[model samples]
Each structure stands twice: as C-alpha cells, then as structure tokens.
Target chain A: MNIAILGFGTIGSGVYEIVNQIQAEELKDCKVTKILDLPQNKDKLDIIVCDINDITEDESIDLVVETMGGIHPAYEFIQNCLQHKKHVVTANKAVVAAHMSDFLKSAKENGVQFRFEASTGGGIPWLASIQKAKRIDEISSFYGIFNGTTNYILDSMNTLNEEFETALKKAQQLGYAEANPSADIDGYDVQNKVTISAALAFDSKIDMKDFPCFSMANITYEDIQYLKSHHQMIKYIGQAIKKENMYEAFVMPMVFASNSLEANIPSNFNIVTLNGNTIGELKFYGQGAGKLPTANAIVEDILDIKNQISYGKVSLDKKLSYCNTLLKEKYLIRTNCPIENEWIDSVECKGANYYITTKAISTKDFMKLVNSISDQKAMIAKYM
Target chain B: MNIAILGFGTIGSGVYEIVNQIQAEELKDCKVTKILDLPQNKDKLDIIVCDINDITEDESIDLVVETMGGIHPAYEFIQNCLQHKKHVVTANKAVVAAHMSDFLKSAKENGVQFRFEASTGGGIPWLASIQKAKRIDEISSFYGIFNGTTNYILDSMNTLNEEFETALKKAQQLGYAEANPSADIDGYDVQNKVTISAALAFDSKIDMKDFPCFSMANITYEDIQYLKSHHQMIKYIGQAIKKENMYEAFVMPMVFASNSLEANIPSNFNIVTLNGNTIGELKFYGQGAGKLPTANAIVEDILDIKNQISYGKVSLDKKLSYCNTLLKEKYLIRTNCPIENEWIDSVECKGANYYITTKAISTKDFMKLVNSISDQKAMIAKYM
Candidate 1:
C-alpha cells in the first residue's frame, strides 16, 4: 500500500515517524511512495520531498494526509486528493469543521475515505468513540474538555494563582499554546472541535458559521477568585448537548472544583464523556495532543484503511448528514449589563448573572446575536 | 443484514431493546430477523422463537448471538455457527476466555466475526482499544478493575465495614451478583478476564487452566484492618505487565491505597489503564456491567456489522488475529502457607511471602505451584 504525506511539517513528520515505527507486521509492501512538502518548507528534509500539488493528483498515492494548518492550499490539496479517488486523512480542524459537508459529499461521490480523528482530540480516539457510541443507540448528549492548550493555561492559573497572561506564557513555553493563541485562548479552537464532535455525535455537520462560541477570553481574575470562593475552579469547557430534537455546541468558562471530575482534567490532557440511551456514560482520558499521539491516530487510520483494502472492501462515507441542527438551551449566565432576552433575543441576558433560555433558537441565530453584541462594542456575552 | 439472538436473558433483553430503538441510516436496512431461545425458555409470543440447533445451522441467520451462560451446548453451537460462516457475537466470557484460541481460529478460518465485547468491562469498548493498540505497537502493561461485582463488594466493604459474606450478600441483593457468587468470589471470573487481556496485550495466549485462580475468598475483617495499617484499601485487581519477551498476568487482592488512582474507581465502575509506550498512561472508565451497558456492547457490534453491510462490506474482520502461542512469566507468590521455593532447585522463594521472581517460568510451572499450595489447603495465593 502506497501512502503520501501532504504538508510535511510537524504532523507530516510525525506521520512519517509513525509509519517508520510499524514493527509488528512486515511492511515490505508498504511505502510512503510520495512526499508533498511546501517546496520551500525546508524544516522537513528527511522524506522524499515533492511539490504538494503533484501527490494530490498522483494515481500511485492511495492515501493523502493534510497536516499544514489553516485554510489555504490545504483545502484545495485535500479536495483534489479526494477527487483523484485518494483516501484523505487530515488533522486540520479549520478545514474539517468548515468544509465537512462539502468534502464528505464529494468523497462519498468519488468513493474515497474522509477521516479526521485527530481534528478534535489529537491523541485520543474520541471520534471513533462517537461512531462506536452511536452503534448501540442514539447519542443523546456529549460533552468534554476537548481543547488542551486552554486547559493547560487554566490549570497553571489555578495551580500557581498566576495571572492569565503569565499562565498563557507558561503554556506557550510548554508548547501547548501557539504564540498567537487567539483561537485556543478565545475559544475558536474549541468551537471548531465542538463542531466536529457535535457532527460525529449527532450524525450531522456543524460548521463554524453557527452559534455564539462562548469563551474564557473575557474571564477576569476576579471571576476566578469569586468562583474559588464558591468552591469552584474555572475551566474552559466545550459542550454539545442534544436538547429536544436539535443540539447546542459551545465552549464556556465554568467553575468546577479541583476535585470534580471535569476540573481534575489537568494540563495538556483531555477527558471526554459520551452517552447513549443504552450505554449510560463512558469517559476517555489521555494525552489529547502531542507529536506521538496525533501520529498514532493517523497511523490507526492508515491501518484501518489498509485492512479495509486488504479485505477487498473500500467505501467512502461522506454524506455529512446528522444531528446538525442547532441547540436551544436555558442560560444561567452572569454579566454586568442592562439587557433582556429580547435585546440578545437568541440568548437573553436576564438578571445580572442569569439569562433567559433561547426559546428554540438555532446555532446560526445565536451566532448572529453574538456578532451583534460584538458590534455594540460591549463585552458581548458568554452562555452557560 | 440479518441477525438472530439467543438466550432472552438480561443481555438478550437489552439486545432486543436496542435493536428496536436504534434509528440511523447506517442501521435502517439491518434487522434482527429471528430470536433463538432455550428449549424450556418461556417468552414465545412477542418475537420469533427458534430452537438453538436450527438457528446455528440455518443459512438465514447471518449473525448469531449467544447470551446463554455456561459451557455445554453454548460452545458447540457457537463453534458450529462459525463453521457455517455465520458471525457470532456473545456476552459470554466463560466461553471465550476458555476457548478463545479455538473459537478465534475457527472464526478466522471460516471468515466470521466472533465478538465478545460485553465479556469485559461491559461497554467500555476494551477489545477495540486492544485491537487498535495491538496494531499500533506492543502493549507494555494493562491495569484493570475488570470485575464490577467484586469491585462493588470491595467498595461496599470499605464504606460499610461489612464482612465479606455480608457484602457479598448485599451485592447479590443489589443485583450486582448472580446467585452463584463463587464465579466472582473464587477469582475464576477475573482469571478468565485477565487471561483474555493478557492474550490481547502480549500477542500470546495465556492458559488459565494452568494458574487456577486464587483470590480473597477467606479474607477477614482483620485483614482489611491490616490493609488500612499498610495505608491500603484492598480490591481485586487484574493486571498484565510485559517484561521483554514475556508477560505476567494475574487476578489478586492488591493493596490499592487512597493515594492511588485505582482507589478513585468506586462501586461497580471499571477503569482499565494501559501504559502504551507512545500514548503514555491512558485510562478508560465506565459502568462495567448493567442491562443497558452490556446491551450497549451487543448493540455496538450489531451497528458495526450493520455499518459494514450498509456500505456493501463484510462485517467479520480478517486483519486482526488472536495469539495462541506459549509464553513465560515471573510470578510473585503471596500465601499464608510457607511453601519455600528453595525446596525446588529452579524456584527461589523469599520468606512466607515468596518473591518468586525466578527466571521466566512457564504457565504450567506457575499452576503447579498454585495446585501444590492448594493441595496443602492453603487459603489464598496471590501471584504478582
């Protein structure tokens, strides 16, 4: 089986290492037939470097992996790979959450596998669990601390009683945070993650263009101290709860004490819980992301695909249809603002720290409300 | 895709409930075609009932489930079904752990799936994790609280200070135990589970027939108090650790103290920790057994098969294979009887608590030691 490495950076190099380390089975027939680098991206020199464009359309490359972050040629490269009937494996959440519907549709049409287990919790196999959970019965609710960078920062702040910025610096030093950590710090990373998890859990596609992705960006040190006084520790939590027939996906700063199961999820580790009608609750805890763990998922996909091909069966499931509908939730919010459910109608800001429930509002509706709040130059709002 | 269920008992009823409740595109075409029951078993009106013999040979049943407890015709029937190229899914651990090598080989030879997910940890999906772990790399160690009944008994004993007998009786009253407590208390159940886990983790078969499990069957209240003095709360722990080319597997009463993570595992909940070289220490926690959770695994297998079928693929995997080879392990013996290992030239025992970490010993040798001690009417012998 021939596989291609696309966007040979940190993830690409990790995948190469993973393939190199396959010792159990004889891989005499297996090879990384091609390497797709940024051409000038000299950080990756070990592999057989080729233009990223060549392998996307190469007939010999059976699998193509996208590791280069952001929404550039990565999208085009992955789409083209799928078009060429190559199975596409990616760790890029930005591409998956945004173009999942389109990509899944195209991949299914073209008979190619589209997998992104690393997109959500990098190291842990949370995506497969969702698929596995749904097999028994419908997944009613799903929630977790999906993002590790923010978790590390929050953990550091709580542990050392350090300011947020100092904790953020410590996180960056530990490599859990990017230098420009807006996505992780402000909840965009978690938003993208919950979008993917919501899709997998509900069998629906949830794009970033929906919902007010509640973040800890605006959380003050005073709030943390206040939470401590209430026997709580603040955490950036990502949740996707199925209420009624739809769903609500968000990341919020909640206060759970250090001893609470959720709060105990320490630095750079992820603990995810899933529930089906039949299977109560199952929680998976592990190193959510790292060079080794992320590569592990990619390798698993490789083995899964390889085994499928060996068994003379390969089918791409790209329908992108599932519990994609938005979630309406009763908000237990706290804020300093003169507001009502009507002004922030989608998510009503009620009494100081409370908010009215979004009476059957969708994610798109809430996104608009949040954008409107942002437009007013107010500290917008965060939902519970 | 059509399937039939046998034994309309606790797990069988769960299989029925989930088959009726599931509503997904991947499962729409899949159906439970028939239900098989014992000759004297009652429920006749609500579903199609067929004799187990006919169901086993019938060409119509693509998959057969065995919820029937004990060996007897259960093994013979399942074996016949696999020979007929019919996939078999069972919640029966007694059958699998005893003849996993035989059944797995037959299934592989005949191109059928013989799944027993419910056999271990109810619905925590340990087997799939094991399969993935095996494919990824060599599993270094596994620590599991696999038996929920014993766990409940231990937890009850800790919290209530009830005697072992009282706690066992209370567990029985709470539906945590079957009428026959020996299956759980005598350690055969955990021995069977750890045997399977050992095989899965070590890439080799472990003979339980050799070791003949010994547990805390005669533990006294004073022993519990003694454990507390040692700063440890006792629980039946199933562990398998690999050393170089060999592995050690056992079910024993270990001193899990308050400071340890395993101590946090409360009640009938199960937590299995795997220290993979790459993934560090990963822990999977959930309800080990219940009507819904056990049913959850059967439902998961059904969905897994259904998804494959819905995509025009075979449900039974041909890639994964069971290890049926012999291996060696160093056993640490702890017993009341002073069976000094120095009496045997090859075996060296230290004090009454024999630290028989002699050169790697075969399973047969380990069992000989157990039986020799048991022959002297030794109360308990724990192997580390």
Candidate 2:
C-alpha cells in the first residue's frame, strides 16, 4: 500500500520511522510515496514535496497520515484526501474535535476510513477501547488526567515543593511542556480531548465551543498545601457524566485522596477511567503524548485501515449538554476575600490565604459563587 | 443470528439478561435458541436442554457461548461447535490457556472465529487492547494483578490487619472466592491468565504447566509486616519479561512501592501494565472478575464476531523457554534455616520468624536456595 505523510514534524517523523525503519509486519507492505512539508524541509528528505496537490493528485497514494496539528490546512488537506477516496489517519486532536462529523460523513460517502486513535490518550489505545466497549455496553461516564504537560507541572510542585513558575519551567526544560503552554495549562488542550472522547464514548457529536472547562492555573501553592493538610492532592480532570439523554462535561482541578490512583500518577503519564453499565469502571494509563507514543497510535490506525477494520456509524442520538448544575458536589474554595454563606464550612488560614470547604452544592451554584468572588483571586477545586 | 448457551450458571444467566432484557443495538438481532444445562434447570426455562447433540445438530445456531469454565464436556462441546462452522465465545480462561492453539486451528479450518475477550482481565478489555497494540508495536514485557479474589484477601490482610484465615473467610462470604479456593490461592488461576496473555501479547504459544508461580498462601502475616516496615506492599503479580526470542513468565508475590498503581489497587480491582517498544508503559485496570463484568466482555466478543472482526494468525516464531536463571531480581526471604549467604543484606527477627532482604540474584539461584531450605518453610517475594 502506498501512503503519504502530511507535516514532517515530530509525530510525522516518528510515524515515518515506524513505517520505514521499524518495519513491523503489520506495516511491512506500506510504502511512503510522498511527504508534504515546507520547501525548506525538502533538502532533509528525498520524498519531501512542498505542494499538497502532489499528494491529493496522486491516485496511487492509498492512504494519508496527517500529523500537522491545526484546524486550517490540515482539515482542508484531509477533507480533500477523503473526497479522493483515500483513507486518512491523524493525530490532530483539534481537527478531530472540531470537524469529526463532517469527516465521518465524507469518509462514509467516499468509502474510506477516518480514524484518529492518537487524538485522545496518545499511545494508551483509550479511544479505540472505548469505542469497542460502546458496541456492547453503555458507557455512563468517564473522566481522567488528559493533558500530560499540566500533570508534570503539578507533580513537580507536589514532589519538589517548587512554585508554579519553577515547576512549569522544569517541565519545559524536560520537553514535556511547550514554550507556549497556554493550551495545556489553560485547559483548552483537555477541552479538545474530552470533546473528542465524548463524541465516541457517547456516540454523539460534541462541539468544543459548547463545553465549559476550568484551567489549572487557578491552583496556587497555598491551595496545594491546604489540600495536603486534608490528606488530598489536586489533579486536573476532564469529567463527563451521562444522565437521562444529556451529558455534563467539564475540565477542572479535583481533589483526590492522597493514596488514590489519580494522586499518585507520576510525572507526565495519563490515566483515564470509563464507567460502563455492566463492565463497571475501566481505567487506562500511559504516556499521553510523545513522539513515539503518539506515532504508535497513528500507526495503529493505519494498520486497522489496511486490515479493512472500520467503525460503524455513530448514533449521534444523545445530546451533549455541557451543563453541570444538576449534580451537587462539595467544593474547596481558597480566597483572600471573606466569603459569607450558610453552605460554607469552617474556614482555615494557610499563610495569607483563607480556605473554606463548602457543603454540597449544585455545580451551577459553585460556578456562580466563583464568578461572584472573582475580585478576591478565588479558586474552587472540587472533591473527587 | 441465533445463539446457544452452553451453561446456564452465573455468567451464562448474565449474558442471557444482556441479550434479552438490555437489548443493546449490537445484540438486538441475536436470539437465544437453546440453553444447555441439567434437566433440573429445564423447569426454570423452556430452552434448557440436557443433551449436547441438541445444540450441535441445530443448523440455525450461528453462535455458541460457553461459560462452563472447565475443561471437561465444555471443551468438547466448543470443539464440536467450531467443527460445525459455528463461532464460539468463551469466558473460560483455563480452556483458552490450555487449548488455544488447537482452537485457533479449528476455527481457521472451519472458517469460524474463536473469541475469548472474557478469558483474561475480565471486562477491562485487556486482551483486545493488547491485540490492537501488537499490530503497531512489539510488547517487551508486562506484569499485573490478575486475580481479584487473592487481591481482596491481601488487601484485607494489609488494611484490616486480619489473619489469612479470616481474610479467606471474608472473601468467600463476599462471593469473590469459591468454596474450593485452592485454584485461586494456589496461583494456578493467575498462571492460566498470564499464559493466555503471553500467547497474544508476544504472538507465542505458552503452556501454563511450564510457567512457575508462587501462591499467596505462602505469604504469611509476619511477611506482610516486614515488607510494610520497608515501605513496600506485597501484590500477587503475573510478570512476563521478554528477552531476545524467549520470554520468562511467572506468577509471584512482588513488592511495589506503596504509591505505585499496582499497590494502590484496592479490594477486588485489577491492574495490568504492558511495556511496548514505542508506546512505553501502558496500564489497564478494572474489575477482573464479576458476573456482570465478565458477561460484558463476552458480549463484546460476540459483537466483534458478528461484525466480522477476525484476528490474524498469531506467529509463534519465538520459543517460550522456562528459564529464570538469567534474570536478576531482589527477593525478600523469610526462613529459620538460613545461616549465611553473600547475597543477604541483613537479617531481622519479627516475632519468632527471621527475615532477610537479599541483594539482586538470578531467579534460578533464588529458587534453588528456596528449595534447599524447604525444611524451614521459607517464603520468597520479589521486588518490583
């Protein structure tokens, strides 16, 4: 089978190495015919082509791999490839989360496969497993540490007792976090991942714009200390709880017991848990992002396509309403301003910040409380 | 598709309920044509039949589910079904581990699929994930807590400070253990599971009788306390490390740090970790065995077969040699007959028993040492 790789970046290079260098049996017959990248990368490889038409116009290219992350040209290129009756495998979470429905429809109409196993949990094979489970069991809920960059930073702060800036720098030095780390620390990365996962786990079209996500930047050293004193650790989690016909999806920092699996997940590793009606709760853990890990997932999709494995049409019957108001949960609020409410429990002082553990309140009420107390540099972390 | 049930026990009944009452889309067309059981169960259900010929003679029965869990008539029945070009799904790990190669050959010759997702790791979707990963990357090694009953017993002994007998009784009371607990406590259960997993993960046929396993019954309360003082916890693990073309498979008590994922798995929960060439370390955790969880996995296999998902013929290229002499590991040995050894770091007395932590040595030498001191009732647990 002839293939083309779009974007000669880290993941693309890794995929090329696996397909060409590793030469595993599953990919032995696959040959990379073209690699589309910037003209400057042409001198570095013999197969590099600057024009996207070189790939899409070539009818011999049976498949295309898109490691080029972004919503613009990558989506356009993949759409063109699918329209030309070529299967596409991608590691681009942004594109998958944004235009999954359109891509699925195009693939079906063109008689091609559109698979993005690397979009959610990297090499963990999470999304594919959830898809398999969904065939027989109803997944009621799933939540996990989706982003590895923020997890590394949080773990560094917890273990090394370093401030957020120092931990973030350490993560950057280790190449776990990017220079422009807002996508991870600000929760946009996790939002995209959870949206993509929800689409497959719930068999619905989940739009990222409709989901609400809270960043990990709100967690302070004082808040960590407060949680430590209470024998808890803060973990950024993307939770999706299914109810009736609608689902509640959000990304936030939740407190897990010190001895819990979520608390002890070391460094940049990811752990995801899916709750099925008959299967109970199933958890998967692995490196969420890296060159080889993400490449391995993309290769898995390529092999599945080569073996004629394809997923059935998703239901899209259930609506994914990003509402968290119906469920009541206890909250730990840390702020400088004095908060007065009957639901608030006793307050404690750690350094200059005051911490209060509130009684169970609807998530809608908690978000409203946070918005109202924004003047005090307040942060709310829910209990897991 | 018409289906036949080989056994109407716990797992069999659960599968019936899922196919009948739940009525998921994947199983909507499946009709339970006949249920084979004793004549005593005939009054409870009109489909119950004591004769095996009733199922094998029925040409309309396209699929057969075997939850009988033993090697006797269950194996013969499944063999007959495959011979008749009927697909078979089983939850019997013992049968899968013992006669996997035979079943695979039979299925291939008859143009039928033999699926056993429920055979290992219960509803965690472990075997299926490993199969998916094997397509893209070579698995180097894997180890995990495979048995829920023994884990529950060990957890009870650690947290509640209960004796072995008390924990055994508690496990039996909760229905996690059988009245004849010898199979589970003797480590044969885990040995069977790991053998099956090794066959799939490495694409090699592994025999359970050739693999060495140490039971939890050998671990005493005093041994647990000694390990606890060293900031470690004992977990019954089925570990398989790959080297060259040979793999060393064993089920034994391995000590892990208290904060490790394997150690933090509480009660009847199960966790397995696999190290792949490109994916690094991947972990899976969930309920290893339960009526619903096991049933759910069986249903998953049924759906996959219905959708024509077939596994490639596994390559048994590598030889599975039972040799542990070359692999070095630290062992915690408890004995009264130990006088001197260069590998022993130090000896400490806990109550009337003497404990020693040995430096790294080949597993072969450690087992030899244990065998020489058999008169002293010695126990050895390796460090993870």
Candidate 3:
C-alpha cells in the first residue's frame, strides 16, 4: 500500500504525520510511497513532483490520497487516479458527497477502491459505523452539528458573550474556521455534510440542491438571547429526515431545551444522530473539524481498504430514486418581519425576531413562497 | 438473521418494536425466531416462547441478544448461545470488560460473532468503530463518559446545582439510572467502561483491579461550587492511558472548562475518544444508554452476522500489551484534605479545597498516594 499525498497543507501534513507513525508493523503492506505535490518541491527524500499525466505511468503509486480540496483539479486528479487503477483515499467530503455516483462507478469499472470516511465526521469513524450498520436496517434519519467552526462561534457568543466577529476571529485563530467562513457559517458546509450523509444512509442519489440549507448567519443574537431566556440552546443542525417513501435534508438553527444533547454540544465539537428501524437513535459526537483528526479518518479508511473489509460505498447513482411522495411535506418558517400572509400558522416573537410555524405545503410551493419573499429579506428559512 | 430477545424489559420491548416494524421488509434472511424471557411468559405474537434449556435445540435461532444485563444467566446464557453456534449480541459491557478473554475465546472456538457495540457508549457504535479502525493503526489510548446515569447526575449538578440525592432520584425517575445506582454513582459502572475501552484500544488485558477508580458518589455540591468558582464543570469520566507494557483504567470526577466537548456533553449522553498512531485522535459522542438505542446496536450486530461482515473483534488475551511511552500525563486534583504527600509536586489551597499537580508515576503508585490521604475524599482527574 505505497501511497501518495496530493497536498502539503494542514491536512496533508497531518496525513504525512499519521502515515509515518503506522504501528501496524505486521501488516506492513501499507506505506506511503510518493509525496505528490507541485513540481520542483523540496521537503523530503526522493519525492515525485509530477502532474496527473506523469502519475498515470507510475504503477509504484498504488494508493493516492487527495487532501488538495476543491471541486476542480482535485476531482480531476482523483478521476485520473481511478482511471489508472490506483486505490484512492481522501478527506474531501465535498468531492465525494457531490460526485460519489460517478467516482464509485469509475472506481468499480477500473477495479480499484475509493474511500472517504474522513469526508463526514472527522476521526469519529461515523461513516464506518454507518456502513457496517447498513446490513441491519436502512437509516431513517441522519442529523448532526457537522460544522465545527459555526458551533464554536455560536457557543462563544452565548457563553463568553463575545460578538460574532470576535468569535469568528477566535475560531480562525484556533484553526477551526477558514478565513472565509461562509461555507461553515452559511450552512453550506453542513448542507454538503447532510447531503453526503443522506446519500450514504438512504443510498439515494441526492443533489446538493435537493436539500434546503439555513445558516446561523441568517439568525440574530436576539434570537439566541430569546432562546436562552426560554431555557433553550441554539445549534446549527444539519437534518435528513426519511418519510414513508421519501426523504428531506436541510440545515437550521434548532432551539432545544438545555438538557437536549444538541444544546450541550459546545465549541468546535460535533454531535450527530441516526434513526433506524432496528437501531432506534444512533449518535456520534466529536472534534467535527481539525487537521490531525480529519487526517485520521482518511488513514482509517486506508487501512480498512488495505484489509479488504470494505470500500467506501456503492454509489448513490446506483440507488437513485425520484421519491414523489416527499413533495407534500409541511414547512417550518421563522421570520423577523410581521406575518401579513395566510401561510403563517403560529408566531412566537421576541423583540424583532419571530418563530413562525407554518401549515402543510409541498416543498416546491414552499420554495416558491420563499423565493417570492427573498427580495423582502424575509426570514423564510425552509421546510425543515 | 433469526434473533431472540432474552429479556422483555425496556430494551427488549424496544427491540421487539423495531423487529415488528421491519418484519415485512426486504432485509436479507432476517426475522425474529423467538422471544425468550422467564419460563412463564405469554404474548400475542406468533414466536416461540421457551425456557433457557429449549434455546440450544432451536436451530432457527441464529443470534441471541442478551439485554438481561448482570453477570448471571446473561453470561451463562451467552456462553450457551456461543456453544450452540449462535452469534451473541449484548449491551452488557460489564460482563465483556470483566471476562473479555473467556468470551472472545468462546466465540472464536465456536466460530461465532460476539458483538457488543452497545456496551460502553450505548447507541453509539463505538465497538464497531474500534473493530474497523483496528485495521488502521494501534490505538494509544481511549476513554470517555461511558455511564449515562452518572453523566446525567453530574450534568444536572453542573446546571441546576442540584444535590446529589435529588439528582440521583431525578436520574432514576428519568430512567437514566437504576433504582440502586451504587454501580453508577460509585464509579464501578464507569470502571467497566474503561476496562472495555482499554481492551479495545490497546488490546490491554486489564480488568477493574488493574487500575484505580474514584467515584462521583462523593462529588458534593460544595465541590461543584468550588469548581464553578474556577469556571469549571464537573463530569464523571472513565478514561484509560497506555504505556509500555502497561495500561490504566479509572472512573473519576473531572473538572473542565465550560465550552469543552467533555464539559458540554449534557444529560446522560456519552462521548469517547480513540488516540491512535495513524488516525491521530477520534472522538465519538452520543446517547450512552437507552432502551431503543441499545436495541438498535443489538439488531445491528445481528444484521452484521447475517450479512457475513466481521463485527466481532479479535480476542485480547493473546495480544495483551498496554505499553505506550507517554506516561507522564497531566491531571487536576481537587481535594478537601490538605496536600501533604511527597508525590504532590505543586499545590495551591485557596478555600476549604486545594488543587495539586503530581509528577510522573505508575498508576499503581498514583492510586496508593491518592488513597494515602484518609480523612476526606479526593479526585485526580486526567486532562490529556
């Protein structure tokens, strides 16, 4: 298992450190072969500084790990590796979650393995647990505080009485949040997580747009204070609900009692749950994001594939189903403006913020209503 | 996958509910063959209800789920099931942690899986995660708040400043603790958790007597107030550390900052961590114990055996080494008694309490020193 790391950043260095510390001495078939990076890079002993074309002819490169995240060249690098029949391991949840169908098919076609347990919950092995549990029952729901950055910011604001900017800076300093924290704070990070999770749990072909996302950025400090006054804690939650014949995915700030598991998850930690017919509620909580922790997930998957226990997942494209019954679900809308519309069922307002629970409506209709009110800056979240 | 529920208690009833829900599904070769309870039990379901003796002859029963708990019949019953070549799934961490060698040998001899993912961190598939991650790297350490009853009590004490008795009663009322919570509050419950985790993480052949266990039973509200004075929260933690040819297991009351993952774990939820060479550190948090969640684990194991996936772990008897080089760990000790011991490298007594930091010592030496102080109880909580 000679491996190649594609990036040299935090996670890449983390992967290198982890790989160098392999204690499976008896199972020494696994080893890092090439430290792949930009051409003319100097850091280590006899490392290959080659592009994807050069990698194709290198049969010595048995395992390729891509820590170079993004949807472009990372995707291209992985696709080329799969074509060249190199087993691949990655921490790029975005690439796998969005294009698992294509990758899985391509991997199978090329008789190679693709693994990305680090994609979802870093270091927790939540993916491995879910994958192994799949033999027992289909997962009915999957939910979590998937983004550690947002969780840290929110917890700081509530506990330390720090402003959002101050907390954001702290999270960045702590390396929990990126310089541009939109992906995390705006819920798209969680959206990617829930999308990937839904695809894995339900084995369905779910696009990112299939699920709605609502971030804490849309939420005000007033909402947090009010929720706290009511003995509730706010958590940016990524939810995937499976109904009779269909499923729903979204991310929103949930107001739960102080005793709720979601409420107590503080700082840059994560708590996730899965409900199955047989397993009831299964949860995984941990360091949601970090360099070594994230790298650990990729390493675990690499070892797992080494043992031939299992390879990532059977692509979502193979399990795609257009569940028509999910269209008739109800929506939960929270708004800052006064509800002059008939869609509002009940409103609980404190100061300028309000939680307006709405009546049953199709997802399509709810999206239409939200789009119509988008220009007004309505707090029209989504049908969570 | 024909399974049986041995005890018709809360967990057993939950298992039945899940099985009933999935009775008409396309799950491969799975169904409940029998519901085993006491000798005289009657239900409307069309499943076999027989004595323990009748269980061995029933060839249809492929998996035996032992939610009966305790050491007796549950252990003997599981042993019998393994002898009869039926896979055994249990939520009993106590039995396995104490007698893991015997159980693993028995399962191996009979060529049957003895799955216990529902053991320590209930509802969280920690055992399965450990099993899968085993292929990756050698785990250096593993530990967490594995007992929900004590966690619930400690969490209540942290939030509401409730008395221990009131919190214990509340935990019992909320179905988090047993009527007699001596095992939980007294640290024996968490002791078993650490034992199992150590066995899984380091393949350490150490039981309750191998390390030291200090309880939360004596974690007075006064102590809580002192911790609060330092802006800390108290939690009952079961943790393990591995050193060269040695390991330590203990359950004690710990003080942590407000926003820490371990500090923020609310109510009865449990969170554990795996510190391995390749994976670095992975943390799992979840509902540590519950009727439905435990049942889900049992059912999930059954499905694994049915699907021919390797869910059971290798025996820890042969590969029993807990050796790690990082032995000089840091701890925060709080005691009402004065710190006059030679092991106390540093001490600071403010009010009726003192915090002491100790030098590197073997776990046995550490406990002997802490226990040397006779008059008042003390807790030496691990930080790393």
Q: Which candidate gets the maximum DockQ versus the true structure?
A: 2
**Model 2 chain B lowest lDDT segment of ten:** B309-318
lDDT of 3 by residue, B1-384 (tens): 677778787888777776656553334356666878764565545564758766677888788888888888788888998999988888887788777778888888999888787787877778777766666566767767788888888878878889889999999898778888888888887888778777776665775775667767877777677677876777887777666666655677766776466777777778887776655556776677787777767776666666566723565753454333335555667777776766677887857777777766655566677667664566566554
Better of 2 and 3 by TM-score: 2
Worst lDDT run of 10 residues, candidate 3 chain A, spans: A375-384
lDDT of 3 by residue, A55-168 (tens): 666888788899988888888889999999998888887888778878888899999998888888787767766765565566777877888888898888888887778889
* Pick by DockQ: 1 or 3, better one: 1
A178 in model 3: Cα distance from truth in Å?
5.0
Q: Write the per-residue lDDT of candidate 1 for residues A131-162, one digit (tens) a residue.
A: 76765457777777888888887777766787
**Tens digits of lDDT, candidate 2, A1-384:** 898999988999998888888857777899888999998778998999999888989999999999999999988999999999999999999999899999989998999999999999998888877877777778889999999999998888888888888999988999988898899998989999999899888888887777567778878776777788888899999988778677788888899998799999999999999998888999999999999999999888888788876545655667666666757888888888878877787788876677888889977777777777854457778889
**Candidate number achieving the greatest TM-score relative to the actual structure:** 2
Model 2 CA deviation exceeding 4 Å by range:
B375-377
Candidate 1 chain B minimal-lDDT segment of 10 residues: B309-318
By TM-score: ranked, best first: 2, 3, 1
Segments of candidate 1 deviating more than 4 angstroms:
A26-28, A38-50, A157-166, A217-233, A257-260, A309-384, B38-43, B46-51, B154-167, B209-235, B254-261, B303-384
lDDT of 2 by residue, B91-111 (tens): 999998889888888998999
